[model samples]
Target: MLTLPQLRALYPEAPAAHLTAFAAEAARLLPAHGLAANRQRCHFFLAQLGHESGGLQLRTENLAYSAARLMQVWPSRFPTPEAARRLAFSPEALAEAVYGGRMGNDRPGDGYRYRGRGYIQITGRETYRALGRLCGLPLEEEPGLADDPAHAVTIACAYWSWKRLNPLCDAGDYAGLTRRINGGLTGLQDRYGWLERAQRCIPWPEAGSEALPLPRLRAVQRALKARGFYDGSIDGIIGRRSLAAIATLRAELGLPGEGLDAPLLAALAA
Candidate 1:
């Protein structure tokens, strides 16, 4: 039941420098469309940057694609030899070509999987279709956002606007975005839950506050807290209060829920 101001107050002070700057920008740019936490996208983007860019920029001599890790073959990665030469000069753009479908993350030829690139990690041909609709660009035709950091982030923001796909987004309403952005309920958000849990026992931003120590981070936290299944305040930090309440609810459902992440989204979506 925490207001944005209250929720924000719980944020632990974080050092600024790397992600802090991006958080400010993400916060500033996101609210006009009504995304709640600046730290949310900032947090998500920084994590992606870590996975995509090796934390700073491309290694230059290295490539994400290889003969063994090949997913798709391209007749020409660049529009022309000149374009290829152009990419060769910049470590950044070369990474883009590789991630933007030109390079291929997963190469069945070499057993490589399709790992999308760019700040947001745009992967697979299907990803281009969704991102294209949101960003007003033909990702298929241009297919360059994977390496283009700014464009990748911009398109990701457009994708996270929420309820445009779900039509019911409010703060904590991750369902719609999760469903579409992840391409179904059990995609990115779902995997991230486990991976995030494994990484830190919970998904905390690199430099921000924590997810409510409450149960499944759905809008239901708001309602359940109101109903007492969640004694945790409705601030959405995914803390103990929320988790305990979720366990109780799952037992009541007789549905074999994990009481953690496995069936939380399904229970809520159901």
Candidate 2:
């Protein structure tokens, strides 16, 4: 089970109520879903959850995009800057335009009605119906229920089980797992960073028995080195040199506190 401190470390910016709710629900539901079967499983599951929920700060999808962002995100749909501008900052319009005719959302208001919600962002009417049946919740009738942290955790766990993602986690197939969850490899590095941070924060019994994967550290090292804050080899080992580099980078970026967090990861990635 994850302690409050552990949850806080994983999501430093999460609200107190959300943190408390997630901690309780994760502790209660993770084991039931076999997500806590091992350190690796727990790390991967929490990492994906953290990434999907934006460090536990978001339950519903934010469809308010700038025109440029909309064009970049859905090039085929928007195609032109003017086309995207028409829908920009209009969440309902954007949702209806982009999601209306797909994902079993054929009815007129079904897109906005069944927009992405929950930790894993369960979108569309069919998904809501399926997860609703599995969780014994009227998610289709009451989509807002998925916004609750407890229900979000339940929906995420059910989605995980329905997707049969444990074998992929067991095989250390992070890319495949991302593809399954995200429908692609978007934010793959961010997911890895979340996993690395979770591996460090969570009190896994087998933690120092072997060298853990360090893709996040490697990416950080590369970023720091590129910015001339670090000169060490990009071997993914966080030694004194890496720590110093991270501290310097954080200070330079006006970010408070110490060590790697979500903000630091985003800055590095950006």
Candidate 3:
């Protein structure tokens, strides 16, 4: 299972407490959605969710845009600068203007009401209805549930399962998975970065072959334990104990007391 410390280490900008809660909930909910069996799916899921949600901080879409920016983002709706200026900073009106008469939004305020929410941004009344039917929830009528963290993970997993994304994840088809989830290859670089960090963070026992081998961590653990400078289990997890032992060993060797790297591993071995 993905630990909170690993998540914090991967995304240092995120709030640790919030990530802890989210990880707990995801652990509880994602298994039923078929994400627990394969760590690749879990890694892809975390990368997509973390990137889309801005490290699990942003829930609602930031529709507040300057006229120029709005024109750039929604060129169809704001073809002219004057049109963009008319809807500038008015999120509700802009949403209605951009999304109305599309995505099964027929009524007056359906667009704004059913706008993107959840970690994966479950957008549109049609999507809400389809996901709602699949999950046995009335998300079309009560779309606000998608914004709440309590329901966000479940909704994301449901959407993933609905799109059959696990197979793409297993095949390492990140581009295809992104297209399926995001409708395009938007944020491709960032998605890959998050995937790389996630692969590093998840433990090997849980991550299987998808885990990037960190031979240094295990080697350091063994070296420190053999030298009587470490007392913790040789788990390769760099917790406080491992860090303390590394610091002590480095100080004793007149080496830099910061950061664990190849040099530090070599020193520990020596």
Candidate 4:
């Protein structure tokens, strides 16, 4: 329902010229795996990218694209946090202070070299390590990539893909996406008073069409297979038998039988 005009209205400053170029590039890079970005989602991504890079002024924007290039020159190669911090951290002592202690929990501390991170800044060293693994980037190896917008955006894209953040389904409307992707509704209530008043990004699909689709369906099949519920195809289709298998898992897991859709998927993930 979000239109091109609506997209421009959200971030009027995004260069029309650059977006045209980016659209071409994105079309090339995406949809290879049915990962196409519709008009609104494209704007959603661009808005995030625009916000992160000071409206695209920072060279660090979309760091993953150039991380390998930067690493070729920077080459993290650390003997210790102390050695890495000397170059990457603001103060070696402070840097050591955060990550120096055995890491636990997710809250950001100034001690870690990559103090704040993620698409919208989920801070702390533990997050960096976890995100690195999820995205297949050696976050500890190149601590600087966190600050680079290019790497940051690529990491964002990778993170989105890693978790399959489809607004059309699974993400529990917008608040859930905010909680999961933006790290637990920290800024939503404060920023827009939208906590009590949730914003609608994508209308949750109706039943039938709302059935779990590929990759997600595949995950459900895999989980059921692991639990020894369904012995059917691992193909990404949720047929009637898949539902029965999931119903069995639901009864065992003590969850309400919500059949084969978002609620079930959410419970499965939980």
Who wins the lDDT comparison? Answer: 2
The alpha-carbon root-mean-square deviation between model 4 and the true structure, to one decimal in Å, is: 14.0
User: How would you order the candidates by TM-score, starting with the best?
Assistant: 2, 3, 4, 1
For residues 175-247, write the lDDT of model 2, one tens digit per residue. 6788888777777767878888888889787532212356656888899999999999986656679889988
- Measured with C-alpha atoms, the lDDT of residue 106 in candidate 1 is 38
- The residue-by-residue lDDT of candidate 4 on 1-270, one tens digit each, is 333343344435545643343344444444442334343334334434444443434423222223234333234434444444444424444344434554442333434555445434534566667778875778766756765534554565665665556662332233344445554433332323211111233232332332222356678888788778889988644556776897787787777645565566676672
Q: Residues 1-270, candidate 3, lDDT per residue (tens digit)?
A: 657777787667765555766678766777887787887778889888878888777777868889999966667768999988998998899889888889899999887888888778888899999999887888987898887656677788889988899887765556668888877666766777787777767655642446223354567788899988899986445556876887888888888646465576567653
Model 3 Cα RMSD, Å?
A: 13.7
lDDT of 1: 0.44
- Models sorted by lDDT, best on top: 2, 3, 4, 1
User: How well does candidate 3 score on lDDT at residue 120?
Assistant: 88
Model 3 segments more than 4 A misplaced:
10-20, 75-83, 206-270
Where does candidate 2 clash, by residue pair? none
Worst 10 residues of 2 by lDDT: 206-215
Residue range 1-270, candidate 1, lDDT tens digits: 112332122222212232343344554555654444444443333333333333424311244334322222232444444444444444344455555444333333211123445544555555666677777777755666445534544565565453253232222223333444444443334334422332342233445433322243547577556556876655444445766777778777776734344355456652
Better of 2 and 4 by TM-score: 2
Best TM-score among the predictions, by candidate number: 2
